[model samples]
Target chain A: MSDADRVKVPRPVARFDDVTRRFDGGLVALDRVSLSVHEGEFVSVVGPSGCGKSTLLSLLAGLTAPDAGRVWRRDARPGEVGMVFQEATLMPWADVRANVMLPLTLLGEPRGACARRADEALARVGLDGFAHARPFELSGGMRMRAAIARALVTRPRLLLLDEPFGALDEMTREAMNDQLLDLWASSGLTCVFVTHSLYEAVYLSTRVVLMSPRPGRIQAEHRVDWPYPRGEAFRADPSFTHLRSALSVRLREDAVTPEGGAGP
Target chain B: MNGASGRAYLRWLAPLALAVAVVVLWEVLVHVFAVPVYRLPAPSAIALALYDGHSTLLESAWHTLSLALIAFVLAVAGGILLAIAFTRSRLVEAALYPYAVVLQVTPVVAIAPLILIWVGLDNAPLAVVILAWVVAFFPVLSNMTLGLRAVDPGLRALFRLYGAGAWQELRLLRLPASLPYLLSAMKVSAGLSLVGVVVAEFVAGAGTSPGLAWRILEAGNRLQTPRMFAALVLLAAIGVALFIALSCLERRVLSRWHESRR
Candidate 1:
């Protein structure tokens, strides 16, 4: 199809139309948040610690439903959507391959096919040689890589990651960012990543949506026009620094407001 | 073969040495005090009794062991199935868990006579198995229930995200997570099953079948203290064997990832 035809096609991988979620005791986790993610887009959500980024991902995963407004998922079914938690969340009793095979096994795929797909996923995550190793035997980063493999093994069209590298050190996090970018480039998956790091958001996301605290609502959306295969040089680039500081200033302004509210 | 085996050898050898010392001291005390055989038999006398009554004691031991094994198998099935039911349904658990607690707290000795009358004398061993099952069932149920509910929240959410069915969740996630708990409870129940069988046998008396407990009672009535000690030794041996066997099984299943095994 031509670019115009593709543009005319009403295809949205996910759409949040004025969604609001309120907890039992009147804590509003999200309020009137609206966003749309297209196919193969990398969207990063950045906010303060309690700004409902994880909750947004959970809503998208269908683990939780929005209390008000419509959340539309037009891309894939639950089994075709993959998610990574803040923690690695691996089954320690199972080895790397078995952990990665979990989704396929639950899907009732044949054993040999599950094993083959798990192997491929593990290899994609650079864990080919460690397929038989137990989760506890692997390092933290390796464990997270195994978890990523598990998410990818189902061949999901949409991948949701909730602060997956939050616990890692700076060096490992940077390496994982590059690895994740490479995977995204190859797989063409529409990814929604939630993180607190502005630098990470600028480095990895096509569009970064800033969220405000205390009833998380979209504050501002920043579009990063950086080209693919952005290397360490992009991190040192003046534009990268300027964007990071700009987002950081907005977050600082949000923090200074005494009522746990956001500035316009 | 070298240092590790040498250390392992010493580990058991130390306990064996202590047991030998205790036996020698008991022998010396009996001989020096000229104690009557009726009151307390010497280790030598117990050994001789074992030799003389080997066939009868062995037969009785086998009878008791068979009953315990039957009870153990039944208890395992009942406990695991019931625990699964409890985890799956709040209504079932609310209605029935109290009765399970009653079974746990009520002594098997207090119920063995009733079981005997209910099962009849022809099925005395079967009666013993029921009582043994009562004693052995609760640990597995409680431990497994806790294990099933103890699944990591994040992992549980992942399972939910994949839209895994209830059976799939149990089989692929809950069951594997609970193996450590189940194995630990099984180890505890192994010895309890044997004890329950023996106690039930004692209460039921020597009806249509004889067991090691009956042998002990008969020997005691006849004032054959040495023979009584031999029967007691056989019972202790069975308990030890059950414990060792179950422990080996637990280690095999749990050494990979369980914190306790590690």
Candidate 2:
């Protein structure tokens, strides 16, 4: 491509500088890991288990400080960022509306404002009718949607998702992928998704990052220049499967190392 | 649905039927054998005693019930506050938790005389309430501590991500999450508070306001076994009432959220 036709890179929203993390049992999670996510980019991290993919997201979300390196962000304060965990991570005592209001309430926002924001968020996730339902009373997919609504209530500029849809079946997972993309497009939020599925990473990410086994280090980075509003047909495209296979090969190579992958 | 309702009816009816049968059998045996009133009062004689000594028994019961309730309220408040303190600071927990354990392990009856002497006769009920509070406090403290610590790590991380301060964390997350544990502890302490107050009253000896325990002792000393039996019935009723009340509260609070209640 000519220099004039080259893609423009957005300013980095977050940067990790050689972050290292170690546990008490002499387990190294991340070692000298360096990466950056640009503004409004959908970055998916795919790796084998125990490869510190979740740890990277945690650092970016500022849930845990790195043991060694610095995690730099673009002036994102606590309420300016949102997170969705693997499980819903909802308070069982609270209903859907109350759960969505959690972040705003914690910020000590006025009740009327918090309630309005929560209602708006729930409606955005298509969960308006289920706002009064308890978390346990909802189906798994519905619960996850509520969780996403909770993550979005703060109107966060950055959203961190750790395997947010890993538990859903294929159909539901695909539907959620579309929904997530719609949400991401409309809000223009920077997102970092951690997952084990290569297809999922290829399907949703503007860029896919691969990491090696334990003491996770960034192995490779691939960019997908697919246009916005990618439909179901994209999953059937030869290019989609081609990219997934390339990413899968990178994962398998590290998974079957001299020492087997992380224990079940 | 009809079968389920039948089963529910039986659940209540079975115990009541057995209690009636036992009372009937006891009455028959006492009347047939002509057992001494002091040794074992007949069910009819006990019923008569209940009717005759209604005022005295009720007044003493009210005193004991009020004391136990006061202690229970105090215990809930103190235990929850201490538990919050413990969760916030490990240093405070490390220094004070052992002493709380000591208080729990020490027998209230053994210390009742000293408590009465220290607090004086006019405030004997207060001393009894304090003793009941000691018995009731540990369960709440320990349960609340466990509940606070048992918060899901994922949820805790989410709270931290939102910049929830310690106080907000406790109020919005820890306290609500710990409701089941706290309720269960309250149920346990409800019974223990009654036991502590009765034992303390017995140890405190007869003050101006004789509580249920003191009345029971007076009846036993006078060989009014029927009156003593009536007093025992009142004590049992109080315990059952408190247990049922707390259990209902627990169910009402937790049925919507807690798996156990559901």
Candidate 3:
């Protein structure tokens, strides 16, 4: 598409308006955080460990309610939004197919349909022939792949991932990132990815959001301004380096600041 | 035999050889010391007694086995259902859990007479089964309760995210997660049930039908030392057999997933 066409705004798939969340000890996790993700967009939220990035995804997934303000989504029904946590979280007792089939199974779908969808999902994540294999038999990356397959099996419109590749080694993580982008591009699913890695944010997202810790709030948003199907060559591009360095510097500034203090 | 088969052969042979050697030594010592048969019967004498009273002894063995097995099945069913109740409601667990512990800590020997009295001496078999169930059910209840609560938080969150209802959560997630704990508890219960049956039979005296324990008591009264030894041997064999069978079932159920099976 031309720049003119790309500049047109799409419909919002999900929105968070002045959302505030607190923990049991009254620690503010996110304060007055607002974000809007557009249809077919890849939005990556980057922050330090305590920046409420995970809590943000939790809100979108409807696993947690915002203590204040409103979180809205176009499709809020069950199976409309898929979530993947940092850990694969596949049931140890179940085989890959059964684990992937869980969402449909819970919805009371027919057994044959559940199995077929589960197998198709497994194949999508390159886990064909691994349907019958136990989760214990998979390697770390393969286990995460199975988790992603499970998340995708529901064919959700909106995908919320909370550092799903964080535990993986650098090489495996990069490969997964590429695979995730491929899935997103092919499926046209809106994605909101949360990660600590600036390189990952820049490489995979259409918009990279940086958050400040100590009651997390959106500090900055950078548009990647790059075309789709970004490959290995894009990583070496000067634009990619510049954006990554900017995010790194911004993150360091936010990290060193004390609670209730301003960054220099 | 090849090396792998040779190792397997040795594994089987070692235990068998030790048992045979012990029996032979006991027989020889009894003969050499001229130990009176009433005090300790020779292995050969015990064997002969077992043969001579095979019909009566086998019938008694079957009675004890069936009683223990029935108690075991009841304990398993009751324990799991109670555990599910405990998981679904905190109030039920808080109210009833202490009593379960009380039942466990109280000795079966102390309560067998009370059970017999309550169940009535006329229904001695039912009382015996009830006593056995009391002894055997606690391990399964406590373990399953813990297992249900010990679910992975992430998995729990995932299930909730998918909007799984309470029954679906139990059926798809909690029940399967608790299988290993349940199986291990079953192993412990299997042995405890047998012990409970023996103790209950002893307390019941001749009021109940003749079980192996009853046979042993009768043999003791008459100074039939070989018969007592023979009954004791059968009881030990049953205990070992029950433990082995439950262990095999555990391996079968858990081999695909559990670390203990590996």
Model 3, B20-128: lDDT tens per residue? 9999999999999999999999999999999999999999999999999999999999999999999999999999999999999999889888888887888888988
Local accuracy of candidate 1 as per-residue lDDT tens digits, B1-262: 6987899899899999999999999999999999999999999999999999999999999999999999998888898999999999999999999999999999889988889999987888888889999999899999999999899999999989888999999998899999989998998888889889888888986756599999998999999999999999999999999988988998987778755652
Instruction: Judge the docking of candidate 2 as incorrect, acceptable, medium or high.
Output: high
Give candidate 1 misplaced runs (Cα > 4 Å): A5-11, A24-26, A259-264, B1-10, B258-262
Per-candidate RMSD vs. true structure? 2.8, 2.5, 2.9
Best by lDDT: 3
**Candidate 2 chain B — worst ten consecutive residues by lDDT sum?**
B201-210
**Candidate number with greatest DockQ:** 2
lDDT of 1 by residue, A1-264 (tens): 699998876467999998999877879999999999988889999999778888899999998999999888875576689999999999989988999999988888999999999999999999999989988788889999999999999999999999999999999999999999999999989899999999999999999999988888888999999999998889989999999999999988876684744334
**Span of 10 residues, lowest total lDDT, candidate 1 chain A:** A255-264
Count of steric clashes across candidates, in order: 0, 0, 0
Per-residue accuracy of model 2 over B2-106 as CA lDDT, tens digit each: 998899899899999999999999999998999988999998999999999999899999999999999999999999999999999999999999999999999
Interface RMSD, one decimal, each candidate: 1.5, 1.1, 1.2
Which CAPRI tier for candidate 1?
A: medium
TM-score against native, each model: 0.93, 0.95, 0.93
Cα lDDT of model 2 by residue, A1-264, tens digit = 555444564778899998998766869889999999998899999998888999899888987788999899995687888999999988998999999999999888999999999999999999998878998898888899999999999999899999999899989899898999999999989999999998888999999999986778899999998888888788889999998998888778877773654555
